[model samples]
Target: MTPLEILSTTATGLGAGLALIIAIGAQNAFVLRQGLRGEHVGLVVLVCMLSDIVLIAAGIFGIGEVVQAVPAVVVVIRLAGAAFLLSYAALATKRAFRPGALNASAQQGSLNRKVVLATVLTLTWLNPHVYLDTVLLLGTLANQHGDLRWWFGAGAAMGSVIWFSALGFGAKLLRPVFAKPGAWRVLDGLIAVVMVVLGVKMALGI
Candidate 1:
């Protein structure tokens, strides 16, 4: 492919990946919360971007077909994802209803990096939507570029890196606003709602 063609294919992949991932979801919510708290932001962003890279690559390389061929895998993921989300939703609800204010600094002090990493992994991998978006949709889309498919996949991976970096870093700018307990409550409430909705939808295959 010519230079122009490669650039165009990569750009197309970037746009498609961005379009699929820009939506609201459990992963986004978790990243935002961690960013706000300034707790393991780098690790969270790394895990998220890396996970996307792996999934998108798998899809582009044809593992997407293998995944699609096994409906049982998706079913298993759906059930597990639903269970995890529901459990997270309950925790968020409890936090939202707590009498005390949400203190980011105080909360950060209490957090275990290992726990955060584990949660990040769970949020990234357990969600069925990640496979659907990164592996299946982005993979299939990249393959449409023919020989340029690898470049397309590269672009999609770049897009994921860009987005998660922006979200995790840019969120610090909003730290002032999140300093208040009321703001934390509102944010947690929104997260709880999102988790519950997604969990139920996954459970019902909606």
Candidate 2:
């Protein structure tokens, strides 16, 4: 591809990637919460970014085709993802209703680094939508770029890095607002709702 073509393809991929990722979803909610609480934010961002890169690569390399060929795998993922989302939703709901649960200082060490890592990983990997978006959709789109598919994937990967980094690191700017217990309650309540909706949709295969 020529310089102009390379830039165009990469830009297209970046746009497509951002379109899909910049949304209100379970993964985003978790990342936002961690970012607000200032709990292992860097690790969460890194995991999310790396996970996107790996999935995008898999899709661009024909794993998307394999996934399409085996519907059972997706079904399994859907069910598991729903279960995890619902479980998290329950926890979020509890936090929302429990007074002082969202206290900034109290939440500092409430969850250990290992637990936070596990939660973020589960949120990323177990969510079937991640595969559909990063693997299948992005992969299909990149392949359409022909020999420049890798360039497209690179663009999409860059988008992932930009988004997660901003969300996780930039979240500290909102610390003042989140300082109030009421704000935390509202955020947790919204998170619970998002989780329930997504979990239901996945569970019913909607």
Candidate 3:
């Protein structure tokens, strides 16, 4: 591909990837919460970025087609993801109702690093929509670029890195607001709602 063609394809991939990822969902909520809490923000962002890269690469390599051909696998993932989201939603609701002191500087009652890492991983990998959006949709779109598909994938990966980094790090600016316990309650409540809605949608395969 010529230089102009490469730039065009890459920019198209970047925009497409960002459009799908910028939607409000369980994963983004979790990342935002973690960023607000100032707890393992780097790890959370890294996991999300890496996960997106891997998924986008898989799509470029045609694994998306294999996944689509297996309806049973998708069903299993959907049910499991729904269950996990609902369970997390319950926890978020409990937190909303019984919020602890939320001092950003104090970092009081921070969750363990391992727990945070696992939760982020589950949120990223377990969601069926992630597969559909990153693998199937983006993959199909990238393939349409033919010889420039890898460049498209690279651009998508770059978008993931940019977005997650901004979200995870830029959240610090809102630390003063979230310092209030009431803010924590509201944030957790919203998270719970998002999680519940996503879980229900996944469960119903909607």
Q: lDDT value for candidate 1?
A: 0.89
Residue-by-residue lDDT tens digits, candidate 3, 54-153: 9999998898998889978889899999999999999988877753524334444469999999999999998998888899999999999999999999
RMSD of each: 1.1, 1.1, 1.6
Q: Residue 140 lDDT in model 3?
A: 94
- In model 2, the runs with Cα more than 4 Å from the true position are none
Candidate 1 Cα errors over 4 Å, as ranges: 102-105
Q: Given candidate 1, what's the lDDT at residue 182?
A: 82
Per-residue alpha-carbon lDDT of candidate 1 for residues 66-113, written as tens digits (9 for 90 to 100):
878998998999999999999999999998887664654444555689
Each model's C-alpha lDDT?
Answer: 0.89, 0.90, 0.88
**Tens digits of per-residue lDDT for model 2, 11-64:** 998999899999989889889999988989999999999999999999999898
Error of 3 at 161 (Å): 0.6
- Which pairs in model 2 have colliding backbones? none
Cα lDDT, model 2, residue 33? 90
**TM-score to true structure, per model:** 0.96, 0.97, 0.95
Error of 1 at 70 (Å): 0.5
Clashing pairs in 1: none
True lDDT of residue 187, candidate 2: 87
